[model samples]
Target: MGVRVLGPRDLSAARAVIARDPVVNVFVDSLVQTSGLDPRRGAEVWGYVEKGVLEALCHAGGNMVPVGAGEAALRAFAAYALRRGRNCFQILGPARAVEVLWEALEPHWGPAREVRDDQPFMVIDGPPVITPDPLVRAVEPVELPILYPACVAMYTEEVGVPPQTGPDGTFYRSRVAELIRTGRAFARIEDGKVVFKAEIGSVGTGVCQIQGVWVDPERRGEGLAAPGMAAVVELARQLTPVVTLYVNAFNTPARAAYERVGFRTVETFATILF
Candidate 1:
């Protein structure tokens, strides 16, 4: 068995592996499609080859994502990632694969800042459960200024880091603006403040993976999440056939809200944050 950095020549084979489970592969596929398997494109794909065949892949760079990789491949990828000295903000994907990869990297990386070991990978293949909240809508460019703080708050609370650090929020603002331009940023606003928000973090094949879901602390119990999510789902389906999101298993309330919205756990996912 051999593990090596994949190149453009390996794109088709790598894509096939990603295609085997597109939802789980959405983040990697986004890089492949846009960046053409080039490491210089801010991401790279590594493959484990067995007798001249690519058996598994690791998409590592800013995001260290693995797909369809078992023990051997994961070990090699972890070694390679550690050697390259790139910042892997997160390692996420199929539960078993991610766990295996994390185990292999544990000695080198030590404890992670956070480990979400049992994130339910959920899907809404059918219509979302309507929650009768008429306030949810896509955030407009005009509202970016008003809603940017909420996005920052969600990022800080979820990732344990302020997204807009170092006297520069331009990049963060542009990212939010881009999402709004793509019509992917969904939010509920009241009196010029965002109360609930979510975004289609990645899209691939027929699915859009939802992320950055946040509800204002004061608005947590107002029956806002289900309906706000329903609105997000409604708009997302206009672009893709299926909607998916992963939540920390210990988050019973979020899990319950998703279940109420007709989502079923299609698989379990793991996330390791550095």
Candidate 2:
């Protein structure tokens, strides 16, 4: 009947809702798995209740993501988010749910920096069809210098803004380093330069999400993506059963590469970026 911020006591209920579509909800699920619905850990999960049943949920933090949200739930989440005054840089979810949430927030949070309405949510559970790139391997802490610039370039190109603005990229730098430390960062570094790179951005018990996929601009069109991705997928599946990612629909070349690696469009995602 209404939405409320969830906590550790609500973890089981919240996770039940997330498990409704594990792949599509992997990002939020991973957050819950890692943080256990504890807001102090950095983010909050908002749960919508209908007659005492936790029916839908939204992960509220740097990225506001909804899981299994229908129109009614989306509206409730929007009101809650509007009251919180838009702390997140983006609102993303299933295409229709994101549309509904954006429609509700547009009155107050109007004029988003960008609205990506057609992002294909792709997934690959089995081994990749293409040959794995032998050069692609887990990045080491010592290789952070080579990998950092590539991560920045990729973020700027894909998201239209650098991950950090100030001269010090410490926050973003630490994130990349953490991924490397945990063996989640992968890249093909040749001659002290990163040719291709990606990270296992989120990891749930049964699924993992890939993000920040970037190929060196000068090295594009050389058929490196598919094989590089194959290597990443080959490695990622070791931690989880499924690997998933979402790409802007307009990026045909990237889409083609993903398809060549055997990723299929399982759902459509939309993002309203602030």
Model 2: per-residue lDDT, tens digit, 67-134?
Answer: 88888999999999888888888888899999999888998998999999999999999999989999
| lDDT agreement of model 2 with the native | 0.92
What lDDT tens digits, residue by residue, belong to model 1 across residues 1-274?
Answer: 7778888888899899989888777777777887788777757678989989898888777678888887877878878877776577788888898888888788888689889889998999877876636788888889988778998999998888888444664888888888999888989898998999999888888888899999999889988888888888888898888889999999898999888888899898888888
Provide backbone clash counts, one per model: 0, 2
Which candidate comes out best when scored by TM-score? 2
Provide the overall lDDT of each model, using Cα atoms, as 2-decimal numbers: 0.84, 0.92
Clashing pairs in 2: 1-49, 1-50
Number of the predicted model whose lDDT against the real structure is largest: 2
TM-scores for all candidates? 0.94, 0.97
Least well predicted 10-residue stretch by lDDT in candidate 2: 161-170
